[model samples]
Every structure is written in C-alpha cells, then in structure tokens.
Target chain A: MTTLATRRQAAPGGSTTSRPARSGASSVGRPGFAWALPATIFFALFALVPLAAVAVLSFTSWSGLGDPEFVGFENWETLIADPVMLKSLWLSLLFIVLGVVTQTPLSILLGVWAAGNQRNRAILSAIYFIPLLLSSAAISVLWRALLDPNFGIPGQLSWLFGDGNLLGTQSGAIGVLIFVGMWQFTPFHTLIYQGAAKGIPTVLYQAAAIDGAGTMRQFFAITLPQLRNTAITSIILMVVGGLTTFETVLILTNGGPGTDTTITAFYMYQEAFQSFDFGVGSAIALVLVVVATLISLVVVKVSGYDKMNSSLEGL
Target chain B: MKTRPNYAAGIGSFVWLLIVAIPLYVMISGTFQTREEFGDNGPLSFPSSFTLQNYADAITSGFGRYFLNTVVVTVGVVAIVLLLVPPLSYAIVRSRSRGASFVFRFFLLGLAIPAQAVIVPVFYLINAVGLYDNLLGIILPTAAFALPICTLILSGTMRDITGELYEAMAMDGASPARAFFRLVLPLSKGGISTIAVFSALQAWNGFLFPLILTQSESTRVVTLGLFNFQTQYGINIPGLLAAVTLSMVPVLLVYLFARRALVQGLMGAGGK
Candidate 1:
C-alpha cells in the first residue's frame, strides 16, 4: 500500500515536491493527462457515448428515418413475445454449447501435444494454425464451395454422405456452422493452452517421471489445475464469439434454409438494417449486451480477471 | 527408459493436417483452373490446366477497389492507434494518479464490450453524425476497439524500462515530453510493432462493422466485397476462389514475418 501511495505521488509531470530519487521526478509540469486525452476522447465518442445511446434507444420507438418516440417497455414487451427473437437467443446458446463441447477436448489434446519439445513443433503448429490466418468470410466461402452438391468434396465422395450438400438442410446447416466454428477457433485455444503449459517448470514433470508417474498421471495431476485460468479465459472468449457470430451465418447459410441458424446478433442486424425496425432491434441489442455483461461479470468473479488486471497494473 | 513408437501421435498429426489442408487445397486449386474444369473434374482433383485467368478476372472485376478500401481502412485505423495509444500508455505508466489508474481500468473494461453489442447505437450514432456509408465511420470505431489491448501491451512493456533511465534524463534537463520521445518510445519498439501487426490484422479481418456501416460500393471492403461478389457470381466458383486467395495473400505474408511477435502478444494477454 505504501509503495502504491508513493508511486502515485511520484508521478512524473504532476508533482511539485522534490523527489529526485524517482525516475519520473522531473516535475517540469507537462500534464500527463493531456497525453491521454485524445485517445480517451476518441474512446468516449465511439464506445462510451454510443453504448449510452443504445441504452437510451432501447426505450424508444423509431424507424431508422424519423423522430424516435418514447415508448416505455413497448419494445421490450414485443421482444419477449416475438418467437423469432426467442428462437435466436436459444440458437445462440446452442452454438456456444456446441462450440465448447466439440472444441475443448481437441484443443487440450493439441495443446499438450504442442507443448512437447518435439523436432517438428514449428511446422506442426503452423499447420494447425492455418485457419487463424484466414478470414471467416474466406473460410465460409471455401467450405460452401467444398460442400457444393454437384462439385464439392461430399459430392466427389458420394457414397459416404449421399448426394445432397450438408449445408442444404436445417440441422445439417447448424451442424456445419458448429463444425466450422470449431475448426477456426480450436487453434486459438490450443495456442493459449500451449502458452500456459510452457510456463510450467519442466523440473516438476521430470521429478514426477522419476517417481514413476506416467504421462497421463502427470497430466491429470499437474497440467489441468495449472491451466484452469486459461480454460476460463477460453470459455469466456468462446461464449462471446459464439454469441456475436455473424459472418459465418451470413456467408454460409444466410440464416437459412429459413431462419434455422439465426443467432441473436444476426437477428438484431436483420431487424435494424434489413427491416428498419430500429426500436425493436435496439432492444434486442440491449438484451444481448446485458446478457454478455452478466456473463462477463460472472467471469471476472470466477476467473480473477480483476485480480490479474491489478497485478498487471503494478507494471 | 524405453520409448514407445508413438504411432498414435503421428497419426493424430496427420489427421489434423488433412483437415487443414483439404479446404486450403480446395480453395487454392480452384483459383488456378477454369470454372468448367473445376466443376467437371471435381474439387479434390489436381488442376490439370493451371492458368492465371481467374486471378486476372478477379482483379479486373473491381476486386482492386475493395482491396484498396480495406487497405485504406486498415492503415487509417492502425495509424490512429499507433499515434494515440503510445502516448496514452506513456501517460498511464508515468502517472499513478487515481485518475490515471481509473482511466486505465476503464480502458481495460472496454475489452469486455464487444462491438457487436453496441452496433445498434453505433449505427444510429454514425448516421446521426452523417458518417453513414463512410470509411471514416468504420475507422473510428475500429481504432477505439483496438486502443485497449494496444495500450495494455504498450504500457506493460513500457513499465519494464528502468526508472533510472528517466531519472538520468531528468537530470540532463530534459522535459517529460523529450524524455518520452528520447527514452520511452525508443525502448518500446517491440510492443509498438506487436500492436501494429495485431491491429492491422484485426482491421483487415473485420467483418461486422464493414457489413453494417458501409453500404456503398465505393466504401466496400474486401470481407464484405467477397460476400457480395460470391452472391452476385454464385456460378463463377473459380473467380470467387481467386478473390478469396487474393484477400488472404497479404495477411499470409504478414504472418510469415511476424508470427512470433503475434503469438507472444496474444500469449501475454492469455497468460494474464
């Protein structure tokens, strides 16, 4: 606490008292606040103000063209009753569940494999990470072409899955979306887990091996517990990513064979931009924000995100 | 002390490689052949007649305009970020005042708010300000989103610079601003480049803002342009693949050069 206190007083350009021992002790008065002002103001205009605007607009009835009439809870009431909106929220949750279920184990296994000091680690890691380099738009287009019924991979190997494209049906489209989502993001989780695993001292593993602990035993006893925070981070990241998924749904299925894969973000985009129901759309967007914020707050509590920030703050 | 053959690990690697390579090969090979050849021969076959016609068509058919728009937006956002974030990071590092700390915390809090959540008001707000369908509209918000992580990385690296350096510079009668340029910026080159590549990548790959914010062809970026092109030329599979390949080539080159720095930066954020 004393160190923090003195550090506050020791800030370079703001103080007048003579503290020449500290590095920033110039005290020549250039106001560090001025340095941060432009970026801070930019953040205010773009992020802070727009967020507040969204909150306010959620209570109003407006088309994108005219004066917004104040309508108390009307938009909210409609959102609750709208089956499509409800379905969108449910589908978003399903995407998250599917993403976690399919991606987590594969990422963990890949992380463990990559953590080993193997001879071909560089090439192997790069190969696994190729999806990270491409845009979701590109990936969607590539997959869509590869799944085309007449000319795609499935069509070429016709006996395996029959003649129809996987993306042409409702359940198949959702399944493909989940599969592609996992394909793109699993490498990111692998990278995170590998990084966390690399930080573990190798001596612990070596000692455990000498004590006759097998690879699986060492992994269960040491690796999982050490990666708990990273796991939490990955979960939070995936949940947000899943909720905000737009490009894949947009390009691959367009929320189709008829609204089967429409997630909340895409639905909100449709309500506002395509349909011009700005009021209802704003309400939906606000609801999404509220849900995301609640989840993030829980994440901060459970995952020590604030504590991590504090420790990083000392730097 | 004896070791197993590890056939399982090798097989797993092979399976994962096949998973990544299949789609990549499909896309790349499609770019090299004519549409009829691509369709009749099937996607998995080797392009028997490799030609650059698909690339030529992709370029001549307004792909250059979208590519240039993406470059402008990406460069604009990265430039604004590099200019503003470093100074703010310097401020946060040099000052431990409550306001500074609060501001730093505020910036960190911004990470939790994905732009998707705010796109509703962001849309109207941009419209209100008459930036609708404009490239600057996208650049401003993208730069705002980029600031938090960039500041975090820069300030984290800046703090590693010794206090003695600043103290010595102070004794030499240098102003804080002079010390900033002469001392801090020079030392934090690694952090600066890391954020540069990271921000550029984010801006390049951005889809949502470009999708909603800019509706006109003049303001269209590559990500949105690819979607429109695919829709408009649904039958022209080879040309579509060529555009996708062109859109990714720049990022692939960047990744080859800065793979280590990017991994380290993302690792730093993850490790936290």
Candidate 2:
C-alpha cells in the first residue's frame, strides 16, 4: 500500500504542465506562430541572447573594448578565490539574513493585527505602505538626511543622549543600512501576509476561538500556518530583492569605507562598468546567475513556490 | 475572530508607527529649517521659524524640467506597455498551441535573469542602436522588461476568460480582432489597470536603467535628476528633500487612490 501510494504520487502527471517547454518538444497545430513570432524573437534576441552571451563571455578574456580570447575556468577560479568577491558574498548573505530576521516576524505580527479590522487596520496598512509607495532612491536620500552626522536625526539623538553616533562607525552604519532596507521591505511582506490572512475564511478563527483558544493560540494555530505558503514565497522574493539591491547600497555607502559593506553585485559594478573590466564583470554576472538559479531551485523545491505560482498562473 | 477591538493590539501598532514616523517627520521638518537649526534641533521640535527657502531653491534648480521629463517618460512607457502587453497576452492565451506555452515560458525566464546583470551589454546594445543618452533609450528597455511580468499578470487574467465569450462574439463575424477589441479589452479592465499602476510605478521611479543609459539635462529622469541636487562639496539636503517630496507626490497620490488595485496586483502576482 505504501509503495502504491509512492507511485501514485510520483505519477507522470507531475511534469505534464511544465514539460511542454522543459522537454523542448515541438508539436503541430502550434497556434499561430506568426502571431507570437515577433515577441518571442525579440525577447530571445534581447533577453536570452544577452544572457547566453554573458555566460559565454564568462569563459573568455575580453578587454571590454577590443577583441576577446577564450580562457577556460580562469574567471571561475578567480571568483572562487577573490577576496573582494568572497567578502561581497558574505555581505550579501548578511544583508539578506538581517532583512528576513528583522522584517518577517514584525510584518507577520502587524499583518495579523491589521487584518479584518475596519478603521485602524486600513489606516495602518496605508501608513506602513507609505514607505513601499515611495521610490527607493527617494528613501535612500531621505534616510541619508536622517543619518548625516552633522545634520541628521541620529546625530541629534546621540547628542541629546550622549551615545556617540549612528552613521560613521561601522556597526552604526551597517545597522542603519539594514534598518532602511528592512523598513522599505517590511510593508511589502505585511501586504502579502495580509492578503493571505484575509483569504482565510473568518469562520476558521471563530471556530477556533469557540474552542477556548487564546489570542496567541489562535494566531499560532490559524494565521501562521495559513500564511506559511505566502511566507515562503515572500522570503524567497525578499532574498531576490536583497540580492538585486544596487541603488540602495550604492547611495547609502557606495559600498563604503574601503569596500567593508561591498556586495558581489556592487563589486561587479566596480569591476566591469566602473573600471571597464568587461570580462571580469561578465564572470561575476555568470556567478550571480548560478547563485540566483541555485537559490531559485532550492526555494522552488522546498516551498513549491513555482508550483504555487504556476497554479496561480493557471487560474 | 469576533473579539472587540483590542486596545492592547492598537497600542502595539501605534508603537511601530512611532518608529517609522520619526524619520519621516524629521525629514520633512528638517527641510523647513536652516542648516543651523537642522543640525542642532531635535527631530520633533516644531520649526522655530517656518522657512520655504529650500523649497524655493529646489524649484528653481530645474524641478520643473525634471518633473515634466518624468511625466513624459512615464506616460510614454505606460502607454506602450498597455498597448503591447494586452495584445501579446491575448495572442498567447488565444494560440491554444504548444507555441503559446513556449513563448510564455520565454517571458517567465526574464524574471529570473536579474536585469542588473544585463546592464553592461544592454548599454552597449543601446549605444549600438543609437539610443544612448536619450529618453527613448531608457523608455525602450524599461518597456521590454515591463513586458514580462505585465505579460505574466495579464496572461493569467486572460487565460481565465472563457473561450465561449469569444465564440459567442465570433458567430456574428466579430473577428478575432474585433473580439479582442470589444470583449477582451472591456472585460480585463481590472487586470489592465493593475498593469498600468505597476508599470507607472516602475517607470516613475526607475533609476538604474535611466542613470546608465541616458545622459544630460535633456533626458535625465527624476530619480537621476536628484543627483544633480547633490554636489561633491555636500548634498543640497533641503533642495534634495523638496525634490524627493515633489517626485513622490504623483505616484503617492495614485497609490492612495488605487491601493486596492496595487495591493491586489501584488497579491495576484504571488497568487499566480
């Protein structure tokens, strides 16, 4: 019976929706090819071709200005050993972890509190969402004012409290940067969880409450589990959003105080576009692709987000 | 589920608000003070003397031009994405073949490949195509990337549209074109507005693409225009703050009015 259950769950139907393109199958009655031809070829040439070219360029040595020469594994080996690249990898991880730790729980609590309430909750959602509504560039600028040692809020606070300051020092700097990133992102997660929590039938809570469940028990029993799928997807999206961060860190510190807070993407910026090391930049881009793809695969498998998304898409 | 409004829960939220509101209040208030007052005054202190001088400086420093340019670029991009995405999504859903699915996956891949990584090559391509340092340069690529997710959302909305609607219309010789025009466009208003809001936000706030691809006062976007507000000496803090406030207003207004659609749009993306 167990073996039968395993086989039944392992049914060929699992890949049916995905396999059409996954297997590279081309079939007849293929709709109007002429209809989609322009868009497909445009995306292929512009999007796919560049990505593929960057992948190929990862293996070669190009002056970024002149010709190219094939060099096998050189960029990969350099990437693996490069101190700056490794530091960036660490910083990126630190940033993402900090974001998840600080924002996720807070947003979850707020989202739960905010859901299904008429007056205060809607106002609070609107208020929290204000940050998300503003441009990051604007936020970075706004916070930079608040962080300025000579003229910012923290400086005034420190002077008022005699605690030194919050921007020039390394820990203070990293803290503020993380806080800003968290502040901007927490609302997004809150927004998602609120949607997820609201979609749960109100009767589930009423049903649970009637069974003598306290508020905390009701939260743990109903909201968290119901929001788990959204939590997973938002966490993954947060990681992606964190990894893609450029303007925030760029404006905040320009990677700062001798690359102390530098990230791989930022490092790639300095190496390739800033310094015109195109080959090296391409190599880093390929590394990002690999790392991003790995995280994507792991997240998809673990959370089944793609499956969830596909199902959502199929709706 | 049915408890009275918890005063305790309400307080919990107000504390969080206090944390977020401090910086926002301070920033806006700081803009009202002179450099001396800003440097020394507590963030919560009422302005000793209200000053609009900084806002004046910001307005004079080409806020008008930047605002107009942003409007033009955002409007152009929004118009194009709306025009292109609906028809393209309709084709994909209407195709009913393996090709539609293939093309569908093709657009999905764009989401995975970080647009940042493509900047260098995209720069070269844009320059090669002679769009460099121009408004059209940024508009083109922004529209391209916007296509993917917009297409994704619209396609999801499109596929759910029953074939019978098309069939019923088709009996009157409402050709595929006419069906899309009369039926699909009308029915998909929610999805299309969602697409518009999403694209408008992206285009309005878009920085990296415009920063790299466009140059000079002629085409600089609001996000990049704020850079000119800064100097090697020190940032024009008040001017920049006013600039930030100005740039944020339009989109903030939109979000305020259509937040349901905006949040609903994001949830729909995740749900899909």
Best by TM-score: 1
Q: What is the C-alpha lDDT profile of model 2 across B66-141, one tens digit per residue?
A: 8888888888888878877887788788766677778887787777888777776777678778888888888877
lDDT of 2 by residue, A185-209 (tens): 8887887777778888889888998
Runs of candidate 1 exceeding 4 Å displacement: A1-31, A303-315, B262-268
Tell me how each candidate scores on DockQ against the true complex: 0.54, 0.36
For model 1, what is the error of residue A142's alpha carbon versus the real structure, in angstroms, after optimal superposition?
1.6
- With a 3 Å backbone cut-off (N, CA, C), the pairs that clash in candidate 1 are none
How displaced is residue A157 in candidate 1, in Å? Answer: 1.8
- Candidate 1 residue B272 Cα shift, in angstroms, is 5.3
Which clashing pairs does model 2 show?
Answer: A309-B272
Count of clashes in candidate 2: 1
- Candidate 1's displacement at residue B164, Å, is 2.1
